[model samples]
Target: MTMSAVVMRKGGLELIETPIPRPGPGDVLVKTLANGICGSDLHAVTHGAELVDGFRAVTGADPFDLNGQVVLGHEFCAEVVENGPGTRGTHAPGTRVVSAPFLLREPQPVLLGFGGVDTPGGYADYMLLSEDLLIPVPDEVPTDTAALTEPLAVALHAVNRGSLGSDDVPVVIGCGPIGLAVIAVLRMRGIGPIIAADFSPARRAMAATLGADIVVDPRETSPYDSWRSVAAVSDPARFGRQTVSFPGFGFRPSVVFECVGVPGVIQQILGGAAPCTKVVVAGLCMEQDTFYPTFGVLKEIDLVFSISYTLEEFGQAIGHLAAGELRVDPLITSRIGLAEVPDAFARLADPEQDAKIIITPNAR
Candidate 1:
């Protein structure tokens, strides 16, 4: 049977009809219900070659060839169709599920819908996922909300990496989906005084709706400075003298999440951050970035970078959605069918237009 899918070509995305893939050993066929457009998807479409090079550098293997077209998608929720050979089919057919975007392979796992054309992602009408990776979505969780498991898992992982303390202040420097997810997760955990900053007014408002205690426009005031109003900081500017021997000595240490992956942001955070601050970088910056290590050292800053999530974390994200502990309705700004996926990608360029766009690939 043939199915429609959006393929990433050298020039741009192309919608075409292709045979629906049959499940392989230890794989299960799934019908795509909803898939969220991630920021990495935007980067992958434009920088596939660069991504391949980076992959080569990290794993010392060239797994992706930009010469061939590939499907791009990761965050998704689907329903079980059929179980392939050597599979237990943990979930019954027609059961809603979400899984980490990994297909088990010999040496290492291949990304479900990335790396090459052979591994199609959720951009298609149907996909084959590793049976072991599938997690059944609870009956109460809607399909669109369940699709958010991957990104929310990403946020949960980032928050875990931060190792926040009860007294530590949480500051998210970018009110994008990932940033907003972090805010939501923090609020779900009962973490308070969450500060979110963004240049876009729409995003700032979303951050507030998602449970940010304080939302600031970084253009008018630096995010580092805005936290002082709600929390105590050993500020030399306020006291006319450095009260603490080091950064964050007299007050709570700020755990700043660098969600904006553009260049120069790390450097800016290092320049303005308080002493003994921990900066967790969750954003994926593809290009080369510059940051002064000396500044970080002088301020006693701990810089950490985080990516992806563990299987446990992914399941936890789904559990949170099912229990209604995390409300993600505010982050979902638009929903489109597979035909609109291309235009939706274009609309995402303007932050004011959308926060999260869910693509229903099988929609008629």
Candidate 2:
């Protein structure tokens, strides 16, 4: 049987009918329920080869082959349809679930939807998932909300890598989905006096709605300096100076999250950071970026890089949504069907248009 899918060809995304992918051993067939358009998906469609090369450079294996059609959807929710051979029926048919977006394999794990000609993602009517990585969704959580497990897990992992202290203030540099997700996770952890910055007023509003104490537009006020309002420093001007900690005075160092993965953002954050602050890099900047090492060295700033989420973090994300601990419903700004996937991609190029867009493959 053939299924409709939005494939990333050499040119761009095209809706076409292709045979429904059969699940391999230790895999299960899943009917797409809901999928979120990720920034990575946007990069993958346009810079397929560059992404592949970067993936190869980082992980030493290229999962996406530009030579063939690629279906791209990583953040998604699906319903179990059938179990493949050599697989135990852990989740029965009709059960709603989400996976890690990786198809466990022999040589290496294949990135589903981005595995080129073989594995398709949630952009289609059906796809394959590893039973080992499947997490059952609770009945109360909306499918769209459950679909966010992947990205939320990403935020959770980034937060984990941060190793935040109770007194450390967090400053999220971008209010995009990842940055907003970081803010949500920080709020969920009860890490307060959260400061978020973005150029777009709409996104800054979203950041505040997600529990950011202070949201600023970098153009007007600097995010690094926004912390001074909440910090109980004896001398506000001395807070971010290049000297050692003043234990007598209440000084909270900033944990700046570079969510805007552009070239100059790191340098900008480094320049604005306080002494001994930790800067967590969560944004997936695909291009070659440059930053001065001296800026970080002079401030004694700890630069940390974060990537995909762990399985435990993924499960935690599901639990957070199921328990309503993190109210992420606001993160989803729009919902579209498979037919509108191509158009939605274009709209997402403008950051102010929407934060997260969910794709309902079978929506009527």
Candidate 3:
């Protein structure tokens, strides 16, 4: 039997019918329920061909060639339909679940939605997931909300990498889904007053709803000025010139989350960071980006590049959702069926269009 799926081809995404994938040893077959459209998926659609070159430049090795058909989706929630041969019944059939997107086969890493062109992902009606990567979603958490587990894990991982302290004031640099997720995670951890910046008015508002203490439109006002103003009112002595430290200068954000993965945002953060601040690059930038090393050196800044989350972090994300500690319902802007994926992609390309567009493959 064949299944319907939205496939990423050389030209663009295409809705097509393909054979339902069977799980191999140590794998489980899953029926896709809900899949969240991620910024990485958009990047793959627009610049997939350049990904190989980008990876080569970064790691001095071509990770994978995406010159063929690829199934694009990583943030998703599904139902386990079958357990393949040689797999223990750790997760029984009929369990709702989500998984880490990385498929490690021997010496190489195959990213579920991006690296392997033919690897079935959440964009389809069915998918084959490694048993090791599967994380069960609690009964309290709906599949639609569980679809956010992956990105929330990513946010948690980035925050973990930042090593935030209870007193550390975090300034999130983007209000996109990932950036918003960062804000949510920060709130759950009781680490605030969180400051977030974004050029989009809609995103800034969303950030405020997600618990950002101060949301600023970087276009109209400098985020640094906003941070300083908050710091001045909160604690004037801490903002004193002589006592102010490096990296954060007079600001209190010792840890900055760079959620906007663009060309010049890192440089902007570097220039604005005080002497000893830690900047976490949580956004996925598939293309080349440059930042002057001197800026980091002068400030003695610690730059941490974070990618996918750990297995433990993935489980934690699900737990947070299950306990109702994380709010993802607000981030879901629209829901579409499989056939609407191509059009949804087009709509999402416009930065001002929507926040998170979820594809309900089985929805009639």
254-299, model 3: which lDDT tens digit per residue?
6889998888989999998656678999887766789899998777
Per-model tally of clashing residue pairs:
2, 1, 9
TM-scores, each model vs. reference: 0.94, 0.95, 0.91
Residue 110, candidate 2: how far off, in angstroms? 1.3
lDDT of model number 1: 0.86
lDDT of 1 at 19: 85
How far residue 62's Cα lies from its native spot in candidate 2, in Å, is: 1.6
TM-score, cand. 2 vs. native = 0.95
How does residue 170 of candidate 2 score in lDDT?
Answer: 88
TM-score of 3: 0.91
lDDT of 2 by residue, 190-258 (tens): 997999999999999999999999999899998877876776466655354245543333467678888
Clashes of 1: 2
